[model samples]
Target: MALRQISDAICDHLAQPEPARPLVLSLHGPPGVGKSMFHLLAAHALYNRQPDRPGLRCPGLDCAGYKVLYGMDYTADERAAQHSALRAALLDHVRHAPESLLVVEEYDKLDCPMRGFFRQLLENGPVANATLNKAIVVLESNLGYTELHDLLLRAGDRSKIAPEEAQRVLKDMVFSRWLAEGCEERSDTMKMVGMVSFFLPFFPLERRHIRQLFEMRLAERGAELQNGQLGALQWDEAVIDFLTEKVDFEGDFPIEGAKEVATLMTRYASRPLRLWAAAQQQQLAAQQQAAKKGGGSDGGSSSGGVAAAGRLRVADGGMELTVEPAKALS
Candidate 1:
C-alpha cells in the first residue's frame, strides 16, 4: 500500500505543469524490501507506454530520458570519471526529454565528491548543458532503517504513526547519523537530504504481507489447479503454513522480509514436487503393466490413467511432509 501510494504521488507529479524544482524523492528501506523494484516499476510506468509514439522512447536507449545509476558499483578511484560520465549522461537525457527521471540507487554508498555533485544539481535546479527543473530525481538508500524500525516499535502500531511524523523522525535520524560519521554540519550529503521533496519510508513486511507476496508469485507462475485439470501447479495450505512457521522461527523479523521467505519456499518446495512426480511416473508404469497383464478390463483407460497418474500432490503438516498416491488431474 505504501508502494502504491508512492507510485500514485509520482504519477501525480508527472501529470502536473512543469515546475521550477525537480521532483526529488528519497526512498529509504532495508535490503530486499522492494525499493529497487519500485524504481523499475516507476520507470516502466513513466516511459514504457507507447514508446515509439512522438515524444516517447524506450528507457533502454540513451535518448529515452530515463537513467538508473548504482552507487555501489562505482568506487572512489574512478569517482571523477564516473561523475563526468554521469553528468554527461544525465544532461544528455534531460536535454532530449526535459521531463526525465534519474534514479540513483544505494545513494548512501556514494562518495562525498559524488554527493557534492548531486548537491550542486539539487541546489541549482539544473546541471551541465541541461535544465532539470522539470525532471524527477529519485535517490534510494538503506540509511536510517534501524532508527525507523525503532520508531515503529515505539509507536507499537505502524498505522498509528502519521506519515509526516515518520518522515520527520527519519530525517532527524539520517541527519544525526551523517553528523556522527564525521560529516560537517553543512556537508553535501546533508544539503541533499535537506533538498529532498519526499522521504518515502518502505517498512519491513510482516508475515501476512510475505504470504501475499508468495501467493502473487504463485499466481504469476500459474500455480493453481482448475477444472480438474493441471491448469497450474498449486501449493497446499499445509505447506504454506509450514513455510510461514519456518519464517517465524528464523532469527530477526523482517531482516530480508519476503525475499527470505521466497528463498526458503523455493529451496524447500522443489524437492517435494520432484519426489511426487517420480512417484506418479512409477504408479503409471505399474498401472500400465497391470493392464497389459489382463489385470483390469479397461484398456481405453490408459489415457485417463496418464492424466490421473500425472497428478502430483505435496503437503507438509506440522513440518512433516506427506506424499500420498496421485489423485485425479485436478
Candidate 2:
C-alpha cells in the first residue's frame, strides 16, 4: 500500500544518524483520499510498537503530542499568535519526544510568513530550543490535484509513474504556486517545497477500493451474520453490494470519496443495528422480569427474538426495514 510505503520511508529516514535535514513529506491529493489516515497509520508504525522507549513517542492523532496546525482556521490577527503558539508547542513536543510527527493541514491556506516559519524548521536542524532533526513533518494539501491527475493520466498508469518522476512533477506544481507570478524573489513556501524529501500522492480511491473499505468498516463494527453459536461472523455479499453500489453512484464527483461513502454507509447501516440493539435490550429486560416472576430459562434466551425479527432489505434504491429474522449480529 502507498501508506505502508510512505511509513517505511519515514522509518528509514528516522534510522539515520543526526541527519542534516529533517525528513519532510508533502502529501498532495484530493479531499477524502486518506491523508489524515496515513498520518495516523504512519505514527502507529513508527512509535506504537515500542511506545515506552525513551524519546520514542507515538503521538499519532493525540491532541497533546501530535500537533495539527490548520491554516484557514486562524484569522489574520490571530495568525501571528497562532504561529508563536504552534512554534512553542512544536518545540516543546520535540524537546520531550524528538520523534514527534508534525502535520500541517491546508498548507496552501497559510500565509507566506507562517509557511516560512515551518520552512526554517525544515531547513535548519533546530528551531528555538527544540530540534526536529529526527521528527517527521507532513504537509497535506489539495493544491496540485489537477496537475497530479494530469501527470498520472499522461503516464497511462499511475503505478507505472516512477517515484522520481512523481516527485519532480509535484515539486514543480507545488513550488510554482509558491513563487509569485512575474516575481524574481522566491517565497518561504517555495523554499519549504525544496526541503521536502517525498511527495506522496494519494490517488483517488476506486469503486473496488471503496468496497474494500466498506467491508473493513463492517468488520470493525461487528456487523456480520451469526448462525447458531457461530464463532466468526459472516458478512452477506448482498449488504456489501448494496453499500458499494450506493457509493459507486456518488463516486463521479471529484470530491466524493471514501469519506462520503463511509458516511453514507454509517447512516444506512448503523440505524438498523441501533434499532435492533434497542429492541433486544428491551426484550432482555422483559425476559428478566418474567424470570424474576418464576418464568423458565427459555424466557431469558428468547430476548434474541426481537433482533431476529429485524431484517435489512434494499428497496426504492435504498435500505428499507421489514419484520423478519436478522441473521447479522449487532
Candidate 3:
C-alpha cells in the first residue's frame, strides 16, 4: 500500500477518540525496494519530522551500533556492546517524545528472545521509570516469517535450507524459535502487554519499475527537472532505446540498464576524460597499428568512434548553459 494510505489507516485508528492499537506502522521490505525513502517520506508526511531530530526516530544499525570496534571481528563482547546500544536507543526514543513512531531498521540484530521482548513492547508499550508513554515500534527485519524460524534449528547461523524452500523454512524456523522461547505463547496468553506487531510485505522488483525509478532519479538529479512530474532526461532517444533493449526485463535477475547509463555518463563527464577513456578505447588495436604505420595513432579505424565520442561530448555550441545573443554576426 502507499505510505499515505497506510498512515491514513493508522490515523483512523488514532482518531478512534481512543485507540485500541496505537500507531505502529512497520515500514518493512528488503533493501532497494525504496523502503528507506518511503520511511523518510512517511515520517515527513505524517509526523512533520526529519530523521536527524528526536520528534521522529527511524534508526538503522550500522557496524558501530553493532559494537564491532572499527576493524575488529564480530565477537561476543562486541555483540554485547551492540545489544546495549540498541536497547538504549530504543528506550531513549520511547521515553520522551511527542509522537512515538519508532522504525527499527534492523530489529533482527537483537539476539534470541530479545526480538520477542521487543515485539512484545510493540504490541504493548510498557511503563518505564513509573511513567506512561504511548509509543509505537516498527521492527524492520528481512528474516521475514520463515527465515527467522529457520535460524533457531541447530543453535547456529547456518540453517539447512534449500534455495527454493527458503521462505517456508524461514517461517517455520522463526515460529519454532518463538514457540521454544515461549514468547509467542506468553504474548498470546497475556494478550500482549506491550506493543503491537505488524509486517510490511516484501516488494517484488520489476525492470519497468527500475527504469521508471531511474527516470525519477534523473529528474530529481538535475539531469532533468521541469515540474512536479518527472520527465524523461535529456539523453538521446536512440541511446535510451539501445539501453532498454540490452536491459533484461524477463530474466528474473534485478538488472537496471538506466542506472548503468547514468554511471557511464558520470564517468564520461569531461571531454578529455571521455576522449582518452571511452572514445579512444573503441578505436581498436588494429586501428592503432594502422595509425602507427601511417605515422601517428588513428589506425584501423571504425566510424563508430563518433558514436563513442558522442556518448561523452554534447554538441559543441549546441547545448550551452548561458546563452549569448547570436554574437551580432561575425
Candidate 4:
C-alpha cells in the first residue's frame, strides 16, 4: 500500500506540471521498520543516472538534490538560531534543486516553531519566492508506533488488518500527539497536518523480509570481496537462514528489523566469509605455484589451473566450508 501510494504520487508529480504544493508525505511507524530507508530508496530510484535515463548525477543519498535533516541535530535552546539556518538552507536547496527530495527524520522531535516553519513552507507553496512544488517532502516520525505495533500484534498477519482501520488509528494518534505537543489551543493545527498528501505506515518486517535483507547484505559483501581480488565466497540458502535466525524477534516481527541485522552479520557471518575467502585464495596460490614448478621441472604441462570452489553452509551445528567441484548452479 505504501509503495503503491508513493509510486502513484511520483508518477503523477512527474507527469504533470509543477503542483500547487510540494508532494508532502508523512511516514509513521516504529523504529527499524524502514521509514528512514524509504527516503534512501526513493532517492536512488529517482536520481540514479543510468544509460539513456533522466536523473540526477548521483544516486540515493549521494545525490546533491537529496537532503536529510535530523531532529536531534537541533535543540530547543537554539531553535531561533537553528530556524534561521534551516530556512536559509531549505530555500537555497529548493532554489537550486527544483526537483528534489527532502526528508526530515524524527520530525516530531522538532519544536513547535520548527515544525511551524515547515507548516508555512508546505502551506504557502513558496519559500522566499522560490517554489517547492517540484519537490517531494517526507516527514518521518515514530509517533504512532505503539498503536501500530499493537495492531500488528493483534492481527497476527499484516494482510488481515483493514487498510482504512490502520490509517485511521495511525492518523488519529499522530494528530492527537501533534496537537498536544504543538498547539496550546486546538487552533489551526489540522490545517498544517492536512497538508500531508499521504500518511504512509511502515509495518513491522516479517521473517521473509528479514531473510531478504540478509541476502542483499550478503550479496553486497560478496561483491566487496570480489572487487578486492579475493577468492569467491559462495554460500547456500542454509547460511542465509542461519544468519536470519540469529536476529531477535518479538512475536511475529523482528525486534530491531534491519538495524541490528548489520551488526549481527558482522559478528556472525563476516568473519567466516573472510576466513573462507582468504583460505581459498591461499590454497589456489599454492596449487598454482606447485603447477608452475612441476611444468618447469618436467617437460610436461598440465591442463588449466585447479579451479577452487567452496560452499559455505551450516552443518553439524557449526559453520562448514566445503571445497568441491563446481557444478551447474540451479
**Segments of candidate 4 deviating more than 4 angstroms:** 50-62, 182-187, 219-242, 294-304, 314-330
List ranges where model 2 is wrong by over 4 Å.
49-64, 72-74, 152-157, 181-184, 187-191, 223-238, 248-254, 278-311, 315-323, 326-330
lDDT of each: 0.66, 0.66, 0.42, 0.74
Better of 1 and 3 by lDDT: 1
- TM-scores, all candidates, are 0.75, 0.75, 0.52, 0.82
Between 2 and 4, whose TM-score is larger? Answer: 4
Which 10-residue window of candidate 4 scores lowest in summed lDDT? 321-330
Candidate 4: residue 326 lDDT (0-100)? 35
Query: How do the candidates rank by lDDT, highest first?
Result: 4, 1, 2, 3
Give RMSD to native, each candidate: 6.0, 5.6, 14.5, 4.6
- Would you give me the overall lDDT of model 3? 0.42
Task: Name the candidate that leads on TM-score.
Answer: 4
For all candidates, the clash counts are 0, 0, 21, 0
For residue 226, what is the lDDT in candidate 4? 64
Which stretches in model 1 have alpha-carbon errors above 4 Å?
49-59, 72-76, 179-191, 219-236, 248-252, 274-330
TM-score, cand. 1: 0.75
